[model samples]
Target: MAAQPGGRRGPARGPSKGAAGGQARGQVRRSWLGGVRDAIDGLVRSSPARFAILVFATLVLITTALLSLPLARAGAGTGGTPLYDAFFTAVSTICVTGLTTVDMATHWSPFGNTIIFIGMNVGGMGVLTLASILGLVISRRLGLRAKLMAASDTNPSRVHAGPVSERQAVRLGEVGGLLVTVAVSTLSIEAVIMLGMVPSVMAKGHDFGLSLWYSAYYAVSAFTNTGFNPNPLGPAEFFDDYWFQSLMMLAVFLGSLGFPVIFALLRTWRSPRRWSVHVKLTLTTTIVLWIAGAMTFLVLEYNNPKTYGSFGFVKTFYEAFFMSTMTRSGGFSTIDMADLYGSSLLVTDMLMFVGGGSASTAGGIKVTTLAVLFLAAYAEARGAPAMEAFGRRIPRDILRLAVSVVLWGATIVAVSTVIIAQITKSALDFVLFDVISAFATCGLSTGLTESLPPEGKYVMAATMFMGRVGTVTLAAALAAAQKRQLFRRPEERPIVG
Candidate 1:
C-alpha cells in the first residue's frame, strides 16, 4: 500500500479509486431500483387474459396432484389408473371437456368428485380471468402484457379507448364485475337445479347421501357444460324421468349459451331498451341454433330405434331436445351416441363443429364465428358492400377473425382425427366424432374413449386443450414467432377456381 497510487488517503491505504467507484455505482443502482419501484406502483393493475390462463394452468396442475395422491388412489380401490389417466382427466376438466377414462360415479371418491366440480367451475369461469381478478385483489397491479393479452382474448374492439390509465382501470373493473356476476348466477341456478333433482333422485331409490352427491355433481356438470355424471347407471336410469332430464337439459343449455348472452339478458332485465347490439345478436343466434339443432335431431332420429327406441312421442322429442342441446357443447347423452345412424351422426358432428357462442364455457368454432362467417359470405354472394347482422354492420376485421378461427379449428380437428385413426385403427366416423367432441370440448364420446390406446388418449387430450384455449390463441402464438415489420408490401393476386 505504500505506493499504490495517487488516490484518496483511504483508497491508498487498502484499495484504489476503482473500489470507491464500484461502491458509488452500487449506490446508483439502488437508487435506480427505487425509482423503478415507484414507476411500477403507478402502473400496477390486473390483466384478465393472463390471469385466466394462469389460473387454468394452476388448476390443471392441482387437479393432477390431487388425483395422484395416495388417498385418491385408495379411494378408487384399484390404484386408480395411471399418472397419465389422472393427468389427462385433470387437463380435460380444466379445459372443460367431459371426456374421462374412468367413470366419475364408479371410480372417484366424494373428495375427488368435488375437485372435478371445482375444476369445471374454474374452467367455465376461465382461468385467466379468474387469475387476473386475484392479482388485482392482491396487489392492485397488472402488468401491461397482461392487459394487452386480456384485450386480445376478449376482443379488443370491445375495449374502450379512453385515457390509457383510465381505460385499463375501467376495463378491469367491468370485466371483474361481469365475471363475478356470471359466476354467481351460474352457481345459484345450479343450486336450484340440484335441489329440484334431489327429490327425483331419491324417488329413484337412491339413498339421501347418494342422491345429494349425484344431484350436486350433475348440477355442476350440467351448468359448466361438463358431461361428467356421478351415476354409474348412466342416462338409462334417468331416461324415463322427464323432470330430471328437463332440468339437466335446461342447465346444460344455459351453461353453453355463453356469458355474453347471459350478460345481455341481465342488462335487458335492468333496462329493456338498453340491450347492446352484441347481446341482441348473441341471443338471436343462440335461439336460432337451438331451434335448428333440436329440430334436425328430432327429425333425423325420431324413428331410429337405437335413438328413440320405441319410446312415446314425448320421450322421443325430449331425447332429441337433449341431444341437440348437449351436442352444442354439453356432453350429456340420453341415448348411446355410438348407436346413431350415419345420418344422425353426421348431423351431430355438424352441430358439435359449430359449437356454442363466444365468451361462454362452451366450446367449438363458436356460434358467433359461424354466424359472422355466414353473414360475410352471404353479403359477398349478394354483392353487398358490407356484412350486416341484426341491422348492424359487422366490421371486416371481425369477419376475417371469425373465418380464421373456424378454419383453424376445423384444420386442427381434421389433423387430430387422422392422427387418432392411425393410432387406434378405429372407424372414420367414430374417430371423427371423438376428434370433434374433444376439439369442441363437448365431452361426448362414441365409446371410443374406453377403447383408445395411450397415444389416442394423448391426441384427445391435446384436442381438448386446444379447444378450450382456442385454436386462434394457438395460431396467434405460433404466428407471433414470425412477426415482421408493420410496413405493408404491394398486394398480389393468386389464382382461384
Candidate 2:
C-alpha cells in the first residue's frame, strides 16, 4: 500500500507508507505493554477483600489440581480414588472440614497426609491472611491491598470505616501472636498425648516407628479438628482407654474454640478483672454450650443401647463429652456416629449447627453471630432501643449483619441439604447431618460422604467454601454490584403475626 498524502512520487510514497506501518506496529506494541503494566498494578493495588478472595480461590484451585495428579495419588492406596473423591477431599481440606469420603489412614500415603496437614493449616488461617503475614514477615511493610485484605479477612465491616492501616497492623499482630500461641500449646499437649498414646499403641503390638507416626498424626489431626486417622484401626480398639479418650477430647475442645477466644482468655488471665466484653461473652457462651451439650447428649442417650452401648455411667459421661465436643467442630469420634439413636443424632445436629467461635478455624454461623442475634432478639423483646451483650451495645449495623449472616447460612444449608438428599437418596437425618457438617466445616458424618452422588459432593463443596469464607463475606463481595444512590426509598411497614 502507498501513502495518499501530499505531492510525492509513488516510490517515495511506498517507503513513507512502510514507515507509517512500522510506527503503527510499534505504537500497538507499546500500548499492549502499557495495558499489561496497568493490569499488574491493578492486581497489586486491588481491594484487599477482592485480593483475599482471589488468593483463596487460587489456593483451592491449586489444591484441587494437586490432588488430581496421578503422582499425588500414587501410593494413596489401591492406586487412586475417584476424581470426585479427590476433589471433595481437597475442598474439605481447604474448607478445614474433617469430612472424608475415604478412610484417610488406609487411603493416603505420608506425602498425601502432609499435603492435608498443610491444607489444614492454610485453611485454619485464612489463606490471604497467611500470605499477607508471610509478606509482612519478610518485607516489614504491607502493600495497600494487603492491609485492606487483612482487615476484610478479620472484620469486613471495619474496612468500610476508612483505610485500615493501624487496625490492620493490630489485627496482624494479634493473628501472628495467636498462631504462635496455638502452635506452642498444640505441640506441648500433643507431645504429652503422644507419650501417653505410645504405651497404649505399643501395647497393641505395633512397631515403635509406626506407633510414633500414629501418635503424631492423631495429635495434629485432633488439634486441627481434622478427623483423619492415619491408622485404619477403628475406634473400637481404643474405646476402653479412658485417659486416651480424655486427652483427645481436651485437644478437640481447645481446637474447636477459635484462636481469638483463646488469646482473649490468655489476655484476661494476665489481668483477671479486666477482661474485654468480647472475651467474657465468648468464654461464657463456650462454657455453657459445652456443658449443656454434654448433659443433653448424656440424658438423651442414657437408655439408648446404640450410642451408650451397655457402658457404665462414668463411661457414658466420657463418651457423651467426646461426642458433644467433637460435634462442635472437631469431627473426631470415639464411637461410631451411625450407632447414635435418633434423639442423640438430633442433639449432635444442634451442636454441629451452633459450631465454634468467630475469626477461628471452626465454622458454622459462628457463636458470635448467634450471640448477637440472641441479644438483638432479647432487646426487641424487652422493648429496648439497642442490642447489648455483656454490657456493651453492639452497633446496629453489626447486629443487622450478624442476623443476615445466620439467615443466609441457614438458607444455604437448607437448600443444599435438599439438593443432596434428592441427588443421593439418603435418609433426611444423615443428609442433613452431612450438610450441617459441611456448613459448619465440622466434617463429622454418619458415613454418608462416600455414598454421596457427584451432585451431592458439589453441593457439599460449595457449602464448605461458604462456611470457610463465611456467608457475610461472600455476600459483601457480591453486594458490590449494588450502586449507591443519593436518595433512599421510603420505609414501609408490613403486616406480621
Best by TM-score: 1
lDDT of every model, 2 decimals: 0.74, 0.72
Q: Tens-digit lDDT track for model 2 on 164-209?
A: 3321213544555654665566567667777877777777789999
lDDT of 1: 0.74
For residues 1-497, could you state the per-residue lDDT of candidate 1 as single tens digits? Answer: 56546555544375457987998899999889767655434432332333344456677888999986656653534665577788889988888889988777767766677788888887887544555455445446555444443434344333212123211112433555565666688789889999999999999999999899889888888888888887877766888888998898888878876665676576566774566555656567778888888888878777888778687887777777788889988898877889998888888898888887666778898777777777887998999999886566776867766777878888898899889998988899999998898998998899998678777777888888878877665554344233358899999999977
Best by lDDT: 1
TM-score of each model, in listed order: 0.84, 0.83
For model 1, state the Cα shift of residue 388 in Å. 1.2
For candidate 2, the per-residue lDDT at 58 reads 72
In angstroms, how far off is 131's CA in candidate 1?
3.2
**Stretches > 4 Å off in candidate 2:** 1-45, 74-79, 134-140, 143-145, 159-199, 481-488
Per-residue lDDT value at 86 in model 1: 85
